[model samples]
Target: MKLLERILKYQIVTSLCVLTLGAVLFYFSVDYLIDREVNKELMRSKAKVSWQLRHINELPVYILQLGDSLQLDQVRYPGQMALVERKLFNEFENEYQPYRQLIFYERVEGAWYRVTISKLLAQRQQLLEAVVMTVTFIVALLLISLLLLNSWLSRRLWRPFYKTLRALDSYQVEKHEVLTFPKQHTVEFEQLNQSVTHFTDRLAATYQNLKEFTENASHEIQTPLAVILSKIEGLFQDESLKESQLVALSEISEAANRLAKLNQALLLLTKIENRQFLAGTEPISLVPIINRKLRDLEDLIEQRGITVKTAIEPTGPVMHPALAEVLVNNLLTNAIRYNVNGGTIDIALNAGKLVVRNTGAPIHIDPELMFERFRKEGTHSASLGLGLALAKTICQVNGQTLTYETDGPWHILTVTW
Candidate 1:
């Protein structure tokens, strides 16, 4: 979830809970206050009735109405007053409505009289509801306003942080550039910007140093390797060498050759990883590359007496021409090198995908380890096993997928973008 969405979700839930509590409290408070006001009005009606009874020498009947009632009865307790709420059935309305009752005793002409005054509370109840609803509506309106305001403010406040996030997402260590984040007033956002800038600067520096070292080492090692191979070639012309001495020299030559091949493979891998093969700007066809490689290896294919079949549809995938050549060469090399004698090689390309299958013995190694550097099949005894690794690296760098699978007696290597 997005950070702002989570914050908004949490804020809405908390605000609802608070609004519910406040609404309940507001409802009860308005009911209580309205009841107090109603009670005071009822007490004033009682007093006015008492004044009329004392001066006019008759019971006060004007205070009573259709929805209200007053009653006087002789009582033992005097000077006591109380109010209570009750529901009474109205014969005229044919329904029950709430009423407020004021019960009190007063000494009138030396006799104790209990006066009961009851008033219909339907209007007061409506007034209480209106007050509560108005307050709740206002509270809800304020809550909605706060939510909108918070969303707007949060978007504005986090603008700089989001800009920094987008920059970091696209930052590449190989790119020789520094990120320039916008200035932010928030302490946390400023800290994040500083941390990312420092970290990427360090990473770019480290990558540059490592790249220089690999290139230097590869270059330095090549000179010595060439000298050693040349001196060994010179030693081959010495006729005085014994048979055992010749065998020793042959072993040394094989070891040196392997070392040279290993060094070239490592250097190629480093270059692929460093994106050094991105210099070529050409639209290359996989079909042409495949056909050229097949022709180059036609001698070996005929010597092995292998049958080749091709089903190619012309495609133009834009890539570095040299990388494209290396990709096809590695795949074809592995297919030919590891195939059975007089086996079949099938090449298919269409719709931006290429599949090369060769008849070979079932491979027993973990399928996942097949692309690792120095991983080899059991039968390819003289192989260094970096061919498929290099192919996979090239595919990755060029935004393609390389996968290996075993289909019966055929080993299938597929490249797709």
Candidate 2:
């Protein structure tokens, strides 16, 4: 059976058992109470007869006539009248009361004298029947109420969860739409709805990003490889001039370099997107890291006449030193590559914030567009525009924020923890 039906059945069975036990106990109790009342009335009548016999000296003959009219039998003395017919007698007779036998023989002359008294058992069968009927009616009403209540409660409790399940079932990966869950009043259901919504959204985003990355990587890799193959074929066909062959060989080498860079970019993006950089965290002094990267790029920095400045704090225990290194290297490279002749690159790290500002001509391209892969802002072949994007991905994975803003003659790249 379904869950609701099973719950209803269990509840109904339990309620019925309780009601049945109560009815049985009520039936017995009612029977006992009625029997006691009836016995009291019968004993009262017997007491009146005993009282009349004790005051026999002042009794009239009409008292005997009265006893006949009342269907009561009398004996010679009070003790003799106690046990007349002895019907339905008690197993243990009362010790304080003495019994006497009185026979009600046929009437003689006008006297009509012989006597026998019979005690009747109390009428409890009708009382038991009434109690059963009353309790049955009450139980029926209670069962109806319980069923209605159970149904209402079940619907209210399961409504949100049902909606969540339906949403999940209808989710489409290709569509890439956000799944929304209904709000719930119950705490557990509300929490469940929130968790499901979060999980589905994350899954959809990851799937879409991976799909786009695959498509872009294929296109990027194929174009250059095709150009290189075509150039080599063309060079083989031209056997007339050595200079033409040399130029073709140079073109082929350049194409190969471009292809290699494309592959490396694709691999690096995949690694960042796949969260492969999250190994362990350690204390990394930003000053040393920046100085090392600058030293490595000293030739390029000097050739460009870019004056670099740094102010870093001695912070401990930053997240994922490898990722941090990648982020810093990418930002510094972008700043230096885009800087003007004799430009200035200011790098600062204090507390948990790091800012890399470069003095150059105002960036004509939108800063937002610069973070997209293969989107170069100007005629700079050295920049494939994947560096900033990679840095952004690393920051996102490590729970940091990277933002870009320009002030007057300087473009600022800020990373905050």
Candidate 3:
């Protein structure tokens, strides 16, 4: 859940608990007050009835207050004075209702009589019921008002936060663009925006410096490497050089070429990992690239006596054309380099997928480990062990899956987009 939603949830739960508890307490409080008042009225009536009984001629018919009835019963002996409450049947309403009665013994004209003042509680019960409904209604209105107000406040108050989040979402480091924000009223949001601006500024500067350094270093290193290879070629053509010296020169030339290839491969891998190449919106078919690469490596395939099979479609994945060529080249070359003589190579390309399976010696360990740079299954002196690693890096940067598996003597490399 979003931060605003979580806050609102906690607020709603807290309000409900407090409102419910308050309502219960207030309801009981009101009921208690009403009961106290009813008891007071009954006591006042008891005093009046006592006076009337003492002077029997002053009042005789009825003396209870409104909604109350007075009753007197003659008895041989007075037992006790007490107050009691019970449910009584009302003749007018034809229903059972609550009543509070004050019972006391009195002596009148040399005879013992019990006096009872009974008060009807139907009105009090109605008042309490009304109170409960009113409290419930008020609480509901309060909750609804709180919810609406909280939602409005949360959106209004946290607007700056969401705005900052959106800015970060669309941020691209390759663009080297620094983030900027309007002034925020909230202190925390303003601080957060300022922090983000500073962070992006630092990141852009660092990326630019690194990119410049990589390009400059590669350019600088390539110049000397070219000179060394050119000099080694000159030494190869020297007529006076002995056979041993020529052999040594050939070895040096080969090592120099390998070093140059390694440098270029590492540079390409670094650039790909840095997202220097951005994929296009549309998927570019790999069939043409696959066919072209196969033609370029046809002579090698024919020399190795390896049979090649291809099942290709026009569909492909979204990627930069240059990176796509490198990816396919590495996969295909790696297959050929490791394949057994007179073996078969199967290539399948469909919508969103490409699979390359080459017959080779069975591998005992995991195929994924081969994706690591300089990790090779067996000693292939000509192999730099970087082909699979470079291909894996390209797929990762382009949001594709490159998986490897071995079945019997066939080594499979699958790329899924």
TM per candidate: 0.81, 0.47, 0.85
- Residues 46-143, model 3: lDDT tens digits: 89988888986355545666668888889998887787889988888898888999999888889988888899998899999999999999999999
Alpha-carbon lDDT, every model: 0.86, 0.71, 0.91
Each candidate's root-mean-square deviation in Å? 4.1, 17.2, 3.3
- What's model 2's lDDT at 383? 71
Error of 1 at 296 (Å): 1.9
lDDT tens readout by residue for model 2, 1-417:
877789989998998998889878887788778767654544554445445544542323343321122244434433323434233433444322222233333232333444343343323455667778888998899889988999899988877777888888887655666777666778998898788778878988987888778768777787877777677777767778598677868777676777767777777777677655554565567777788899999999999999988877876235677776777789999999989999999988888789999987777767877777777767787676689888888877777788988899998999887
**Candidates sorted by lDDT, best first:** 3, 1, 2
lDDT by residue for model 1 (197-251), tens: 8888888898899899999999899889999999999999999999999999999
Model 2's C-alpha root-mean-square deviation from the true structure amounts to 17.2
Worst 10 residues of 1 by lDDT: 276-285
Count clashes in each candidate, considering only residues at least 3 apart in sequence or on different chains: 0, 2, 0
**Candidate 2, superposed: residue stretches over 4 Å from native:** 1-241
Which residue pairs clash in candidate 1?
none
Model 3 clash tally, residue pairs: 0
